[model samples]
Target: MSKLVFQSVAVNTDPMTQPTPTPALSAPDLTEIQTGRLADPFSLLGPSHRGHAGHLVVHLPDAQRVTAVIDGTAYPLAAQAPGVFAGMIPPGSAYILRVGNGSPENGAQEWEQEDPYRFGPVLGELDEYLIGEGTHQRLWHVLGARVIRHEGVEGTCFALWAPSAQAVAVVGDFNQWDARRAPMRPRGTTGVWELFIPGVAEGASYKYRIIGPDGRELPLKADPIGFGSEHPPQTASVVRSITGYGWRDAAWLEGRAEAQDRRAPMSVYEVHLGSWRKRGDRPLSYVEAATELVDYAVDMGFTHIELMPISEHPFAGSWGYQPVGLYAPTVRHGPPHEFRDLVDAAHARGLGIILDWVPGHFPSDAHGLAQFDGTALYEHADPREGFHPDWNTCIYNFGRREVVNYLTSNALYWLEEYHIDGLRVDAVASMLYRDYSRKAGEWVPNIHGGRENLEAIALLQRVNTLTYGAVPGSMMIAEESTSFPGVSRPVDAGGLGFGFKWNMGWMNDTLRYMEHAPIHRRHHHHLMTFGIDYAFSENFILPISHDEVVHGKGAMIAKMPGDAWEKFANLRAYYGYMWGHPGKKLLFMGCEFAQAHEWNHDAELDWAALSRPENAGIQRLVRDLNTLYRGTPALHARDCEAEGFAWLDGGATDISVFAWARFGGPGDDPVVVIANMTPVERPGWRCAFPQAGHWDEVLNTDAAIYGGGNRGNMGGVVTEAVAHHGHAQSAQITLPPLSTVMFRYRGAE
Candidate 1:
């Protein structure tokens, strides 16, 4: 079998439906690309300067007589002005325009030792950019041309923008670093260097080296908008358009979209594929990863699957945060299209896909966007706008028009190009702060000197607005750790406009309280009520993020108190409480089971933890939690929708049990949830329900399947109820030690 033997199947959302129309890719106009025609320059150039137009106007001053030299043919300028020139030039072609000084008294001049007009703007083919002033021109041709595949052609084209280089050669894993074997030929009039490799196709990595005027050959340069990487010393990745994959998730996307529209409960299983599992030998392909993990998520009953940074990163363990190329999915995991297939497969299984997009910072690797076009193109020029000290990365100048478009284009790229349903913006706090990771002397204040980063804020707001406007179903999630007000609020309503923000404080406080509480006095009366107090502040996702379970913090299951049994019980109780709380939920990999060690990406997740009943119990509890969430509306229906929930009790007997009613008719069943933080089981405890009759146990953290003592109220059975509360009949319920129980009852419905 050949390398290109993979199938190219469209992952349809409707198996019987036709595919959607392809999006448009329009090239810019021609006159906007040329500064002056190479055919005739003497008449076009004035006595003073020569100018070209693209996004910005470049003025070349102190020029004398100008003439066009192309294919050994000369064209004299008609003297449009003394030395200034104006004419049209076609894109994808190159011609030389020479200048020499005339008489000084005649307003003509010659070059001095350090003359500024000695050089002209280098012309190269420009890739279609959707952002910046370049958007106005609509198209550009700088030093390179798009090298597209031709049918039945066993060749490749080398395009570049090196007008000053004496020669350019393509090298890499393909040519064995030999320059002479593949010398680039000059094409038409465009400065583009062209070449065709007879045997090289997709997946064959290659790079280009430019031989300078001094006869020095530089290494291959990474594509400015490449979607993948083999970074630094490594050549640019080979092309593999993602129009290929075997996907089966068409129905899943439709169902999931409907559920999301209905504001249904969503529990996401966040994974870092490389870290999730790795055998000792070769890595698992994307297909294998999808097969292995998709079923696990479905079995666990999670409604969504969130992946960590999957964009191509050079390092194996940077958590995909230090992205070198935004266009390429990490080739380490697999090809670009394989990731799409994985997502499509997941969607087919009723799972929503959320990507971790890091536009806040980029790595400083040579093959990355540190500096492109021989300038600070992708970043700001000064320390005030360019660098991130904490992560040791490069910060994009969001204030710049091109920068805004770059990131905004990136935001739309994943959604439009890869069919991702949502983005979880990482390091939002860093993006929002100018003083982030900076000491007094190191920090650069904004113009107002108020510690506010307006540019970043504007960029985020634009991102949210543009992302939501372009793709209504796509979600904008923020990992903003600080108390950034209105993180989940709409932009027009004086908020940052994120659909959801990670509830870091809630996670930290709850975990701290849970870990410190003694089994006997684990009452944590004050801490247990934290969720109800600020739950309405924003749309939040309670995350047991990878940050919490790594770097010696130990596993979430290990955060529980006491012996193995107690620990399992404690974890179940914690999860049960979190689920019942008024927020959406997300669990990092390895947290589903009670792994013994902190997560290590280089190592496989401790699957052996399942052998331990305590660990297995935690996993079962999570699955049960997902089921319960789907089964009961009282838990998650009110999370993002308008005022769908209210807390009836906050200080109820140092136990912090609360009552909440989901969005439904007034006569619908009201869910009564009770949590006993104290190790004292309130047996035969009477809790007041809104209606009379009996209430069945929907979910119990102490259930036997979840590795508990099986002290649960039987389901589907009716019982007599007694009332102690005002104006309503109540039911008598049994509360297990350090556990939570939820019951639905509405006038015996």
Candidate 2:
């Protein structure tokens, strides 16, 4: 037997009494009714409430007959409208209804009326599915910080932060597109909408029907505060309740609740859901992907899984950065509940989840940010601040208080509501620099007239401050490519206060060296040693991101200048050196197995590449790199600390080599590392370790698993005498031709 939680079940008159309001009810009550399959939570089936009177209505869009078995009493109906019928059931009767076309008709549209609500009756036609307990309390349960609501002349006023729209209106399950029937009045100074629908309360689904100058009616959208939803590109609707979902991870939450700082080394595996896999052709359900990805990352030694934007967007290739619905998770891939299930499942596996949130810009979809609330509800009035000239997208107005609350609140919502571990703010450089894509005359400076965009910075600071305060374990990250100093510093210390910043400079410098130099001749000595100087500016993660491989840029493997075998070997060497270098690491999707072609968002990663031994070897190298990094104290030892790493030597390019040390703690072994970048292999390349005696080869770039020639001194072997400062002391040794060798000191006994 299925579980049912209904406060009170009531029924009214049948369809025969619908044309006129009957003084006496002829329909039977609960004793005469029978129940069919209970609709899923948010199911369009089951009886939907019609206004506040508790009248129930069901729609049969295509039906020659409408038969409802109420307590074993059956009622029949004829098509009164297009594939539709009128219906009024006896109050308090349990119902089992079947509506279908007795004779097949050629695509006729069907609808039903005679009630206050017009809800579609098919459960499977839309994106969301019914789950556990369905209740009014669960409806619109999620609260976002930014919804600007005020008491108005007749009712409460609500507004958003969409500055691009010329006009906006409030439309939903209510009003039926009557412009003046429930027009949202604009708040004079704020460009927000004011309305007072006294009857409208929680669970009353509504959307902003914005009108652009083109005279088109935008589709009704879901309120970001919706407790349960299918999300979008599907139309937003009111969900009654969800029951039976069991949530675990109490122990993890207990530890994370006190302070977010404890959750450090937030290694995130960024993923695009659709492109992550192929389910024969279509994308896998969130449950399927989440289960597999969590297992993969946890086994691979990553702490967190940061999903590329999962917000609702229409385009297939956008990677979820161009969001259409501010609050809704995309319905294109799967239902919202399924997404929640995925997060919950991940939590059960003890893995943290982060979402790549794009609140800085929105797409130009008429149904979304454009003309919302009869104006630019989600953006700014000033064209200079309202547009992203480079991306052809609408820029958000950071100065707006409501806007600030909306975005920051979204950060909090994902963490609190869905148990997301953190957020990686995308395109932060565009948000931080006013003149980023503008010419001298094309931009307006902030009040301070400084290079930094003050408003945007202020918004980011607030977002970080509030989000961190709200959830202590939640991390805030910035994808700021510009040289924004102190971006990851504390807010009280005059910085943006992000937990970490993507080290774009490091990625560029390293990739440039690998692409241009033969092992023998590298021009920029600073390329290898550059990060040490700036590593203290902010906590950084070196990322070989998607931007490196798309839009005609060849694959990372293809970028190496040599024969295919040599190129693979060269690539392995470069990665090995990078792993030993300062800062944590991130590689884009296809880089792991040396994907041959550029990344295509519509297609899956080149899985076929695994068949080739070279490609498989590269993958093995990446796995080893991650494993060794995690196992050793030196690699991530100094992350976010003042005395984490130091370079002993900085000069020389040809046969260039350098030594560095990373300290995890006072008594711990300061991991010593050395690198050689010469085009040809040097048989006995010599370097001296800072410490003396029996230094072991902990990690080698020349290993076969990493696509190298397996030509290197193996680990656990003692280093013999090496010449240093005209003295022979057993010290660290360096290999040749783009190689990095790691060593540990023998105890100081």
Candidate 3:
């Protein structure tokens, strides 16, 4: 008997549509298909035709019987090779493959399923063209696993951009984790491999098995654009659909611009979700945080809740800074939809949510983007430009157009998909310069022979431009520490186009000044006033972030150089100074309540510390500070403008005291802030006022409620008819030891 085989047929969509006379399958083809090394499984497998005969092939490993059922008639398929079955049937007959596995130990078990290879390519010409040009603004649309109906069959369409790979296949537990079961078709010249697999739907765990350009099989790689990942320690890309999340934040989204306006008061409470609170030994899930964390932020008078990073990461220690799945919110908390719930929960409570986005570098995990196609596909090939020595991670190859497309779209995805109010890009300083934290010769200079990373700068600008342009009212902030010019300016205006920049200089100088003992504080007086010199250079956020209170830095209370009583007072005073300063504010978790110890990512915050009167006082002071900062327009309206501030006395270095005035627009009330840095009470000390009138003490760090000495100006004081420090009105006030007092001017007496 002559065994009939056919030549590989090219079916644009479905192989069953075309009936043509063809030669038989070669021995080499059978061998290739058996070993999972076949270039095009579509040609060797699935249903094809030769005149009136429809030939079908399926690799049903260990199957005792393989049958093709066409409109109720059964046609048995014979084995051409080990588990490789092929036979003839009526040409153009639509059929499903049925395989039977019978064993002595177990009863006969049979399953019937549609052949995946019978379906055609899901990608169209437009997708191929845009992908080939590396200009796919919606790159995620065509790449990665997407559940869709293809050729009238509901299944998942798998696509990947591995131009350098010799072969690629989709592998999952459904196929017994065998790559040989499903090889993908390469679209011409686009460098994209695609396959539409019937019965492979959402919730399936999958990864790509690639034969690299060197013909060596690389480690299984997780989907670069996967929307979900297996909880770490067992890495696999889960087929979780990111669509159909009906957002309840439309109202909030509409008014986000006004809420995030630079002039608007923005008091952010930054938190690391894993360590913020815990149920037992585990962190609160995103669903639980939706209630607890959101309510807490609102109760604390915060306008926004800034999460450190919810992006899926391999190591919890990295705190999501080294995210492997940027699209997937970490399963450590909850799934993607639950994270969306967290965002919506915040908006429902009138609190905006900001994500600490990390685009500067990615960790080199085996299943991650590292050596994706047996090449440095997502990072630079040269270690000098590719590797981050400081963090021991991989710096992105921003020069590649595809890489740029990937990152830029990722930013937009978070904003559009999750309803995130803003993204505070982390470690931006590292991306701005090529020589960051590197010895001179260890880094590569840009084309201009400068230390600046021009490519990275362009990528940052594009991401900002794209995200803002796509998602209305989306803020792009930079965690930039350098003196880079125009960091918060628009890209067209020769800047990185960030909405705001973290005032790292202010944080450093102020913390250093506060760390010094009171007697020696006179020498560091300039540090306290130095920030005003460039306060308005960029729209700034005065961030006392988590970085300050970790890794031997000690808690905020520990940083104060004094005895227990003075420590609480110093912290309360510093909080006052921070609130009175001219900038948006961000306080790390635990810092608000004066956590007695350094932050540990492994444990929840020292919530028990608030039981102490002094600790509770710090918490009370923060709540009052936020209340005052928000309620008083004079303190915040011109926060980013120079005209809003006036130094009444910056040269009171000998007394370690400072006084400043904050103003709003014309006819608005003016607020005066006076700080007494020393422990000695200076009674009858006169301070300047903008107008001669009765001034009400709005907030005093030394008030009894805040565990203070109760030495303020008896609720309200009338200015005396005396000139002082370039002001028309002067007030004889008692300066409480290590205290800060805020006074709002009332109408003229």
Candidate 4:
């Protein structure tokens, strides 16, 4: 390689047309640019000047001849060193690089392209300040690969935060995956590296090649704020524009903002999209699921559909719990816009969509946030504080301002970008406590030396406040299993600030009571009554979630200890009992029809089982239960209030029978529920009634339509003015074997 020097030569009177002296380039500059280790590639390459004329320098690794093309006129460039070319041109705003195969005689190959390093910084100072302060609530807009127009040229702008990295570059197919050609320019003190490549359009796949602070090359990392990604098994982030989606759910959104009251009926169908239903061996696309899932939910009378996590993950077995891409929806079904379409279609059909969001911990995949920039940037440095024992994953460093901002903004992203109705925050118990699932000496205490994770608490509170304040009528629900106080209360009032909490105690006790044989049920009758002790402690949702049926726990139907026929009857009775209980209801996908097999994330539900009368009957019973729950004010109007429920006879353990009365508001008649746990029928059982004229049997779980023995009151019974069970009116009714019976009070004749 030979060194080349240019002398100053005055030509024309016009400064723009005059030839000027060229700036000298050292050996270090050429080596740094060629080796892809330059922190600021723009300083040494692209358009520059020593005096009046413009100097264009480029590092084309394999080219023999290079030219600076200005207005279609090609100016031959002299070789400063091997693969390095420099030349002077008349000062101009725009130019392109033209190259030819090795020596002109060899005639290798040639191409012309716009220079990426010619553009100025794409982000403003405000973005840098906000991101540095960790208050950039709209960080996604600045950090991701976005298709943008710059300097009258159209292309994509890629930015990433890798403060600990010595250098970073954008590598993609456009550059033959070479990191040297697209080295990013680091903004001052912000730790952000950015580059705008002209002509790089949407759908281009890219990844960041980062050089760690120690001058060692790290594995290529996916864009943490990428809007889209290549389907799994391929980890490259794809440049996708999230705009231009036309939403047609204005009426639904308007009504939701005004009418999402706590007292209204909310029967949710929790569905794992991958396993809900499959087309042959493949899961349905978001568009297909939008129609199929929405219609099914509407017909079943469910108020909302709660989906398991849809964030991008490497392993399907995690069921989206161990997410990698917090911003990009998993491409398993479709792109980000299709997810918006699904949400819009659901709202148009009068069905609300709640996403199951996982923010507690993340999997320890190499390509993920683990050891990002060769440091514990997203997690704690201490193993006790950062590692999750149960999952073998990494706990987020909530104490870090940037990490907190990342998570909090992600919560808002779903609500604002995708129009999600609610967020069912998963594993909130794990986030609330520092010693979760850990024994003594296995965890570190907080600043106050208590189990509470103060940082996580503050993060949760801030996210909840932001969600409720920004998105009208959006819900923030917690799946917390601990006895943490006031989870659903306002943050100012000393609470975690959740809209509702999963009633895990109720689910556990009720399932335990239901698992007992008829002869042994009386001994454990308190289990069924225990939930009411703290039922109104918080706004609750009685969720029989997917967790109950997976692992070795067996299906809900199989959990009952009985003969096949008895099992079906017991499940039906339980369903009626749960619906009548005071709280909103949530049933997992297959549980509505009592799927015989435990839920398998890999396989679809047993839809063929519905052909069996027992299973079909369970389906019918659930549909009617939802209809009754929604239509009857006494059953749903005051679900979260104590005034709605009154125990009629919770102590009838000898015959294993329980009765309760659910009331609406004042002047509204009450509905009485009687559940017989034993197979033996109780005849002429007198139950209490608030009013005196007559009582109508509204639902009978043992009706022959539900695959139970046809046993119930004829139709209606007139109540006599006799005091019984602490009520002024009493009625003699026969309770069916292993059944639940509900009756509505009629006015005086």
lDDT of 1 at 7: 23
- Tens-digit lDDT track for model 2 on 1-749? 01122222233346564333312211332111111111121122124332213134343333466554554454443333343333445554454444444444555432221211222211121111111111112112222112222222112223333333344445555445333234343333333333443334334456665554454545554444433334444555343222235667677777654323421343456677778777878776887877787787777666567788887676666788887655666665665667878888777776777788997898766555654544665677677778788877888878766566666666776776677777889999998887888988777887878767888898888878887787767788899998887888889999998988899888887777777647434566777677777877788887777888888878998888778876886787777777777666677777878899998877888889899988988887777778777666566666656576765545545567666666676666767676666556666555544555566667776676666666666663354566654435444343645567677665543
Worst 10 residues of 1 by lDDT: 111-120
Per-model lDDT: 0.64, 0.61, 0.87, 0.87
**lDDT of prediction 3:** 0.87
Worst 10 residues of 2 by lDDT: 127-136
- Taking all chains together, each candidate's TM-score versus the true structure is 0.75, 0.74, 0.95, 0.95
RMSD in angstroms, all models?
14.2, 10.4, 4.6, 3.9
lDDT of 3 by residue, 487-579 (tens): 999999999999999999999999999999999999999999999999999999999999999999999999998899999999888999899
Model 2 / residue 287 / CA error / Å? 0.7
Q: Name the TM-score of candidate 1.
A: 0.75
Give model 4's TM-score versus the native structure. 0.95
Query: TM-score of model 2 relative to the true fold?
Result: 0.74
Query: In model 3, what is the error at residue 221, expressed in angstroms?
Result: 1.1
Task: After the best TM-score superposition of candidate 2, give how far the Cα of residue 435 lies from its true spot, in angstroms.
Answer: 1.1
lDDT of 4 by residue, 629-659 (tens): 8888899888888988999899998999999
User: By descending TM-score, how would the candidates be arranged?
Assistant: 4, 3, 1, 2
- Flag the better candidate by TM-score, 1 or 2: 1
